[model samples]
Structures are given as C-alpha cells and as structure tokens.
Target: MWEALVQPFAEFGFMRRALLGCIAISVGATPVGVFLLLRRMSLTGDAMAHAILPGAAVGYLVAGLSLGAMTIGGLLAGIAVALLSGFVTRVTALREDASLAAFYLISLALGVLIVSTRGSNVDLMHVLFGTVLALNNSALILLCSIASITLLALALLFRPLVLECADPQFLRAVSRLSAVTHFTFLALVVLNLVGGFHALGTLMVVGIMIVPAAAARFWAISIGGLILAAVTIAVAASVCGLLVSYHFGLPSGPAIILAAGLAYGLSLTFGPTGSFAARVHPYRHADA
Candidate 1:
C-alpha cells in the first residue's frame, strides 16, 4: 500500500511537477476563494473563469500552445469582464450578477467559436481540460510565481479587504481604500485564475479555487483559520486525486475536482459548524 502510494510520485518527475503545481495553486487561489465566499462573490469567480476562455482561445489562435500568450490573453480577458461587469452594475439598473452572467455567457460562446473555427476538438479539450501531468518547467514556474505574488498582495491587502467584506459602506466612508481594495481583489482573482488556467484549465480551475473554500466554511470560524483549512483541504484533495488518476486511468483535472467535491459533500454532512450532523445533534453549552 505504501509503495502503491509513494512509488508513482517518487518515480515520475511529471507527477512531482503536477503535485507542486497543485500545491502552488491551492496555496494562492483557495484563500482568494475564501474571500469570494465571504463577500458572496463565488459566482463572480466562476464568471471570471469563463470570461478568460475567449482570450485564451485568441492566444491559441495566434500562438499555438504558447503559455505566455495564453496567460496574457486570459489575464486581459478576465480583467475586462470584471471591469465591464462593475461598470454595468454602477451605470445601469442591472445587478452585478446579471451583468456578469451575460458577459460570461457571451465570452464562453466566443471562445468556443474561435477554437472551433481554427482548431480540432482535441485542441479545445486541451484548453478546457488542461494537461496537468504534462506540466513543463515554464508552467511550474508560472504557477509558483503567481502563488508568491498572490500571497504577498493578499497579505498587504488583508486588513482593508476584511474591512471591505465586513462593511463596504463603512469602508467607503472611512477611507479611499474601498475602490482600491475592490479592484485589487478583482485583479488577484484574475491573476490566480490565469495561473490556474495553465495548471488546471479554464473549466476546472475555478473548482480548485472554490471547492476547498466551500468545504472549509464549515470547519473554520475566523478568516485565518478559514484560509488554512481551505488550503489544507485543497492539498489533500490534490494528492488523493493525483493518486486516483494514476491508479484508475482517470483524467487528472476532473479527478482533482471530484476529490474536492467529495470533500465538500462530506463537509456538508459532517462538518462542525453548519453541517447536517451538527444540526441534528447540536452541541450544547454547559451552564455557566
């Protein structure tokens, strides 16, 4: 059993690279996901993931399989959607969710159309599904670099961002950091998603970002605890999923997300805070 578990990673350089990339993504993106959950912006993260597709497709069209072009394209596209969604929400009667949904749907269609026009289904699958087991050194470096930048940016932005999440109006009234915090957070989301795009693909990347965060919600009470729990869950899922993919001949990306999904389901049923079992057998405080 130990050999079965340890041999693949020990023997295969690609497995090690995939593990490192998964850890990098989980460390950076999952915390951002926790914030998204706290701010009720989880769907916004999903929308932004889809929004990057067209840009990535354009990059593919121009520079076939070039990581730099795809990353740049995804970053540009995600930021554009975020800004446009914010603009529409501010300038019109439509809510942010409605605008985001509209934009992402259009973006998804455009991305698919572009890919279909110039490439085969295999190419489209590569864009949508990713190639985790085949991560080159460049992809690994990009993931690590993004992880470093994301953690640093989040550290600097932490207090203001917490303030913004807790009370937006108060944050706006008390300081000029409100819009700065908002846009900066959006940029981090885009940056992390772009990183995830290379490691996991546009479709599954948001799962890596969101699922662990969602599962951690039931386990953590404080923001710091939440971030820690989310990252831990993500790492565990990545390991399990990678092993399963190796043993069962499953797709690595979906296997990872499915592992996360399993964690989410277990959290829903058995976690400490808001889980089904918790509600059924509520913890009783001792009389003071």
Candidate 2:
C-alpha cells in the first residue's frame, strides 16, 4: 500500500505537478476567498467560475488549450462579469446581488452555447472537472506562474483591500484609496481564479476559493486570523486530496473538493464561532 501510494509520485510527472499545483493554488485562494465571504461576495466567485466557459471556448477556437490563450480569455471574462454587474447597478436601481445573478446566468448560457458550437462535451467536462492529474509540463509552468503573480499581488493589496471590505466607507472618506484597493483586488481575483481553473476546472474551483474560508471562519474572528486558518485548511486539503485519490484511483480534483467539504463540516460542527457545539454548550446551559 505504501509503495502503491508513493509510486505514482515517483513515476508520473503529471501527478507530481498536479500535487504541487493544487498546494500552491490552495495557498493563494484560501485567503482571498475567506474575505470574499466576509464581504458577502461568494457569489461573485461562482459567477467568475462559470464565465470561464465562454472565454475558454473563444480560446479553444483560436489557440487550442494553450495556457496563455485560456488565461487571457478567463481573465477577460472574469473582469467583464465584475464590470457588467457593477455597470448594471450603477446605471439602474437593481441591487448588486440581482445584477450579479443576471450576469452569471447570462455568462453561463453563453459559455455553454459557444462550447456546444465548437467543442466536445468531453473537453468541457475536462475543463469543468479538471485535467490536473493529466497536465503537461507547459500547463504546470503556466499554473505556477499565474499562482505566483496572484499571490504577490494579493500580498501587496492585503492591508488596503481588507480594510476596504470591512470598512469601505471609512477607507473611501479617510484614505482616498478605496478605488485603488477595490480594482486591484478584483484584478488579483481574476489572476487567482484563472490559475485555479487550470487545475480545479471552471465551476469547481469556487470550492477552492470559498470552502476553506467558510471553514476558517469558524475558528477565526479577525481578518488576519481567518486568513491564516483558511490557508492552513486549503493546504492540508490539497495534500490529503491528492494522496487519497492517487492511491485509491479516484479523480484528483473532486477529491480535493471533498477534503475541503470535510473541513467545512468539521468547522461548522465544532469550531468556536457559531459552531453547533459552541452554540449548544451543555455545561454552560447547565450553569444558567
């Protein structure tokens, strides 16, 4: 069993790359995502995820699955979602949630249509479910580069962006820096999501960005603490998921998601903040 477990790592280059790629992505995505939840922007991650399809379709027709082409397309599609949703609300009376909902549905449909016209469902499934364990060396390099740039961008923006999310009005009035912070964070999200999609696929990568953060919230009551917890969960899940699937012959991407889900469940059930166990503390209630 041990040899079978370690054998894939040694023999398969793709498996090695997949392991490293998932860890890096999880590290970058967890922090950003935790705050997205804090900001009530989880749905935006969902929208950006599905929007990858149309972008990927265009890229496929033009340059096949080349990472440059796909990343460009995914980046554009993600920004377009942000801008369109922002535009609708700025111009009309609709709530941001409603505008984002409309944008996500439309982008999802358009992506499907484009894919149907030009590509196979098999390719779509590969993109949606991921080709992580099957990645070429070029895809690995591209994924690593995208992850690094995104992490670097987030490191620069972390303080201002967190401030803006938690206290947007204060930042805008006092620092005169809200616009810079907001747009820079959005751009980093674009980079992160695009990079994550390469491994986790379009729709499912949202799990990478959102689940660990959701779980981390159970243990974290502050921005910095939450981010630390989320990154911890993300990396643990990534490593465990890859090993579980590699040894057991399960698909790699979904395994990572399942591991994340387990973390989320444990946190919700037992962590300190709003945990079920925390809420129903029998000993405390007995004293009362």
Best-fitting candidate, measured by TM-score? 1
Q: Candidate 2 has which clashing residue pairs, if any?
A: none
Residue runs of model 2 more than 4 Å from their true location after superposition? 1-5, 282-288
Q: What is the C-alpha lDDT of each candidate?
A: 0.94, 0.81
RMSD of each: 1.5, 2.6
Over 122-157, each residue of candidate 2 has an lDDT whose tens digit, in order, gives: 877766777778766777777677667767877887
The TM-score values for the models, in the order shown, are 0.97, 0.91
Give the 10-residue window scoring lowest on summed lDDT in candidate 2.
279-288
Q: After superposition, how far is residue 33 of candidate 1 from its true place, in Å?
A: 0.4
RMSD of 2: 2.6
Candidate 1 lDDT, tens digit per residue, 1-288?
998899999999999999999999999999999999999999889999999999999999999999999999999999999999899999999999999999999999999999999999988998898989999999999999999999999999999999999998998998999999999999999999988988788899999999999999989889999999999999999999999999999999999999999999999898988888879878632322
Model 2: residue 257 alpha-carbon error in angstroms: 0.3
lDDT of 2: 0.81
**How does model 1 score by TM-score?**
0.97
Task: Return model 1's CA RMSD, one decimal.
Answer: 1.5
